[model samples]
Target: MEHKDNRYTISGTDIEEVKRKNGQSGMSYNEAIEWMAKTTGGRGTAIYSDTNMEEVKKQNQSVQDYNKNKA
Candidate 1:
């Protein structure tokens, strides 16, 4: 699993993977969170209980945006 500021990708199923999967899928942050939860069977830290998802999402967004341009 690859860890990001805002989330973790399990088995190559992170935001970028999803974004690429559906072609401009426009998946919401919450949807992504839920998707991760379902996919990992609660193994993903990004969607684990006691997590402040909104905060993680905000923090991660900045990093993701930066990476987008940097990459």
Candidate 2:
């Protein structure tokens, strides 16, 4: 789901949305994703590689754990 932006030469899913949320309306690609992960609910499970996916799942679990404790 790569959304290509001709103006900035960047690509990602929901590039405009990510940029809008981050107040970086020009940012794109991995920067957008990492920022979104930090700001949003949890780092989503699905990623590029199997090993990385597992790591993301673990990180997501930790995030959920922290939030659960806070609540």
Candidate 3:
């Protein structure tokens, strides 16, 4: 999902709620984005690909692995 700047206007409370409900610190960026898209309804053409998502997932996994090893 390619998010346009100023395209979605979700409230802080709503964002917090989503985070709280979706796993808080464990929530991935893509998960939060998915929630926002669902909450706000979809519009405009998708100008992005899943490649960005794959990168995010990779980074997230890296962090998770680092934390696990640290612990």
Query: Superposing every Cα of model 2 onto the true structure, what RMSD results?
Result: 14.9
Task: State in Å the error of residue 36, model 1.
Answer: 16
**RMSD to truth, every model:** 22.6, 14.9, 19.0
lDDT of each: 0.69, 0.62, 0.60
Candidate 2 — what's its lDDT? 0.62
Off by over 4 Å in 2: 1-51
lDDT of 2 at 57: 91
lDDT of 2 by residue, 20-60 (tens): 77784566577667666656634472352234657889999
Candidate number that wins on TM-score, 1 or 3: 3
- Tens digit of lDDT per residue, candidate 1, span 1-68? 44564443554446756657777766677776777776765665454456677998999999999999
Better of 2 and 3 by TM-score: 3
Clashing pairs in 3: none
Model 3: residues >4 Å from true position, as ranges? 1-51
Better of 1 and 2 by lDDT: 1
**Which candidate should be chosen as best, given lDDT against the real structure?**
1
lDDT of 1 at 56: 89
Give the runs in model 1 whose Cα sits over 4 Å from its true position.
Answer: 1-48
- The TM-score values for the models, in the order shown, are 0.30, 0.30, 0.31
